[model samples]
Target: MLTFFALVHQEDDSAYGVQFPDVAGCFSAADDMEQVIRNASEALALHLEDGDLPAPRSLAEIKKDEDVAAELAHGAFLIAVPLISFTGRSKKANITMDAGLLQAIDDTASARDLTRSAYLASLARRDISG
Candidate 1:
């Protein structure tokens, strides 16, 4: 897993803006803080979809940059965003779990009109990103 540091800024009446110093031209925005991490991850994935992945700088290194330091001096902040890679391929997996839990998962998946695999994958993605 690769994690990149995102610089976030918000003015008095605007949405939160995100920028990745390591990946040029990759950015994201969210109306609130709760969506920042998820939006940043999606933006990064889309930005690198057809390009080579850039190596991420360590948190220490990023915090040392003059521009980043200046931003931090202001009200801006930083967040670690995980980059989840997708290969566009699927393979079957066999696993064991409690029957009752499996039934609940099935019910939830059905209610959301998603397959069991899809629901599980969504949960995994959220967990990994957070």
Candidate 2:
């Protein structure tokens, strides 16, 4: 699963917080940035579940949002989150390949001008969507 990073800025007073970009809505204090992040994630997850996804605006659009600028001026930390990637992250998974298979993977790597590890990784993710 591909997860994006979320940067958070916490206020010393813990009163009134703001989220990054124009994507996540601004948050009022009563909670710290961590709480804000948690809430934002929950809200995002709920939105995704309901299929009420927001159109992903480019970074430029985000830069032009006055609300975002105001929030940033308040020392809000940039927090990136894996909105689309969360669904595929399984809590636990294990893969066991036999030695012969490993060797075959290495051979395939040699044939493809890629390292064995790279070959195995590509094999694992051959069908993954971008």
Candidate 3:
């Protein structure tokens, strides 16, 4: 699933309501900030599951919350939330292999009736996790 950053602002003087601009119809609020954050998580989860928002960022985006919130006081607080990027992480890691590693991979793939890439991927899962 993808995630997206949103600028949720208070829409009224009472500050009881919040609205996510980047996300249409995505509004979550509570009597307090704690509840608001929890509700926002649920709302964000639903929004992402519904595939309404864009892909989220791996790294947190820079935003000015206090100033933006003041600017949007008539609405909701302008918050910079770290969203889950559906595209996943972009960082790369280096791995070492022997000269005959490719040949061994081919042999394993053929034995399992799988592609070399698939075999390697499974190997990676096992090696990394188990």
Candidate 4:
């Protein structure tokens, strides 16, 4: 898991706009505040899908940037956006849980057309990001 600092801008009567300073050219937009993080995460994932991603800069470093400083001066704000990598490799693990609970998880996953591991991973990502 990695996290990026996204600068958000909202002009009068306009949608919220997000741009990742660490990942150049990566951005997203949303009409509602609640969608900003989710949309930004998706944009970051797509933007990083191809090659090696550069290391994320620290907040202090980003804040020191002249461009970022200018944006901050104009009312833009920052938000932390979590990046989850889908490695496409499977790993096996052993855990103990109540049999009924396990069965329920499996049933729910099946209903959603996802494997148990995928369902659990999604839940973990959401919890961690939130």
Task: Compare the candidates by lDDT and give the number of the best one.
Answer: 1
Candidate 4 TM-score over all chains jointly: 0.79
> What TM-score would you give candidate 3 relative to the actual structure?
0.40
Give the lDDT of residue 44 in candidate 2. Answer: 48
lDDT, candidates in the order shown: 0.93, 0.52, 0.54, 0.88
Worst 10 residues of 2 by lDDT: 1-10
Candidate 1 lDDT over residue span 45-126, tens digit each:
8898889999999999999999999999998999999998777999899979999999999999999999999999999887
Off by over 4 Å in 1: none
Report the lDDT tens digits of candidate 4 across residue range 3-117.
8998999999999999988998898999988888888887888899886888988899989988888999999998888887667788899889999999999999999999999
lDDT of candidate 2 over 12-108, digit per residue (tens):
7655443434345533332644355455554445445645455655556665667666666877555554453345444544668899987888888
Clashing pairs in 4: none
Clash statistics: count for each candidate: 0, 5, 7, 0
lDDT for position 20 in model 3: 54
- In candidate 2, residue 104 scores what lDDT? 85
Q: Using TM-score as the measure, what is the rank order of every candidate, best first?
A: 1, 4, 2, 3
Clashes in candidate 4: how many?
0
Alpha-carbon shift of residue 129 in model 1 (angstroms): 1.6
Candidates 1 and 2: which is better by TM-score? 1
lDDT of 3 by residue, 1-130 (tens): 2334455544445444545545667776667555555556556656666475554433233134454446456543445443432343444556578859878888989999998767876665334321
TM-score of each: 0.94, 0.43, 0.40, 0.79
